[model samples]
Target: MNHSVTLKDIAKALNLSISTISKALNDSHEIGADTKQRVLDYAKEHNYLPNRMAKGLKEGKSRSIGVVVCSLDNNVIAQMLDGIHKVCTDKSYQIIIMQSKESEKLESACIELLYAGGIDGILISPAYETINFNYLLSLQESGLPVVLFDRLIDKIHTHKVGADNFKGAYEATKHLINNGYRNIAHLNTNTILSIATERLNGYKQALADHGIPCREELMVSCNYTGATSLNENLEEAIKSYMSLENKPDAIFTATDQISTRCLVILNKLGYRIPEDIALIGFTNTELADAMNPPLSTVHQPAFEIGKLAAEKLFSLIEKKNIDEDFETVLLPIDVQVRASSQPSNK
Candidate 1:
């Protein structure tokens, strides 16, 4: 008779009790198989939806984890999410994902919303603008398990899973050096990001090891966090590097978008890969192998990073008590050499 139907309505319609309808809907062992099927079918037909919060209160758990990431436009994040999904499925948990879009305000709001939604745990890849972890620390002190991945924050002690950015960047820069590419330029993001700072440190270390000077002028910031100025900043960075009387002989890009876009822009600017300049950077896109010169890349194990972070969060969720000591899992990165960064003749 009413537009909105409840479990009480379904029970009354079927001449049953509310408890019976509830148990049937929840697939309780006490309910007969025939009754369960009937209830499920009826609910499906009538578009009956259970209240998630109420269910969580009843079971004392939401059975869901909240995931926050910077963006899904990049293939690396997509692959990492796939891995997180796989782990969640295996653990009989669900994931609610949100994007911060590289804004700290959005990130803080996402955390508050996920906590209010009663998520049992959280997995976050911090945004470039995320500098404060006080909120996250308060959540942890309040017993909410949080796992940081990829773009991590060191202030909040929690489970961190990410690629070895330092090692990856070191190897990438060394690859360029081994290939006879001296005067290597680094395209890095804002130093606020742990990934950016770690990769830059590795790049500098590699240059020092190879007896090459770390030129400050050759280190450029593309400011990828702000999409409005991303292209313009990248263009200026490239033009500045090229304008030098003794420009860099090689370029090492720090992130996925920076790596791929630099190649495109370089080609557009009439520069030949590994001829006029060598290129290597961090990227996990499938297009790497199919590029015009087949880009050499420092490939982060995105899927593995996701899977590991999910596993760690689930461990914290299922375990009765965990140690105060936190874990930092630094997964290895793979350097795939290709035509773009082949040994230079000169």
Candidate 2:
């Protein structure tokens, strides 16, 4: 095996003390510029790189942040990652990504591993199954600056960045109501995530504001099971709704996946969209425009939210304090009214 060169070897070759070589390599103010240049040039020539782990141990910083998301298969998360990458790259910081697959146990394990790895900070869009904020609180107490994005835990006092879900949902629901959708139903997710709750509240508030009574039975909660199971759940929910004495005239889906499933199920049941059942969705998915009738949707700034979260986390890492005066960031949502939600000329 080839032997690795060390600071001691470099010091011997340069006829300088190891501490002097170390200071020069670290670009410490104590070392003269000429000495620093010499050490850097020698290191480049010899392909000598300092051990990051040892340096991190000495400096109490890793220059690396851990990012955890529920699933990489999600397009929303993919866009968010692009934004995070842009910010981290500009700062010359490394990001370690971990997926929890919506499992709380796996999510906790990932957090523990990142904490043990001496990460300077953590950015997380927690698993849907994470109902409590204790684990996140523990991580904060352990001195790891954590920034929650997209999905959040209200009890945990941490900086968070996310779309204004309530406003988005309200606008989507109100749009449907304005387009003659009196019997509008909400296809809700089973998880009690803060974002989901906010969306539900928005839907309710919109209905109440329009003097429409909110019907509890019209809201169907489906387990978050990606596309396949989501289709199945929507089919069942539609069947039950159609069987009711007063069927829903429209639907406000909580996500793009739910909207797609709604279209499929409605088609399978021989229902004409807009004429029979109007639809509006949360995400601005590519398929929305390509559908038989372009589906209307509220667009969330996923990429911008991710970028802002990463930037805030870096700031927190440098400041080493969580701002107690931090308020919830409400990113703007754009409502695109399309053919699927077009009103009749009554």
Q: Could you tally the backbone clashes for each prediction?
A: 0, 0
Cα deviation in Å at residue 120, candidate 1?
0.8
Candidate 2: list runs displaced more than 4 Å.
1-58, 225-228, 320-324, 343-346
Which candidate number has the best lDDT? Answer: 1
Candidate maximizing TM-score: 1
Cα lDDT tens digits, model 2, 23-93, are 99877999999999998888888888677677766777887899999888777888899999999987767
For every candidate in turn, the CA RMSD to the true structure comes to 4.3, 3.9
Scored by CA lDDT, what does every candidate get?
Answer: 0.89, 0.85
| Candidate 1 lDDT tens digits, 1-346 | 7576689878978888899999998779999998888888888888887776677777799989999999989889999999999999876678999999888899999999999998999999998888888988999999999999988767988889999999999999998888888889999887587899999999999999989998999998877676667777887898899999999889999999888988988998898888888899899999998997899999999999999999889889877555646789999999999989995465
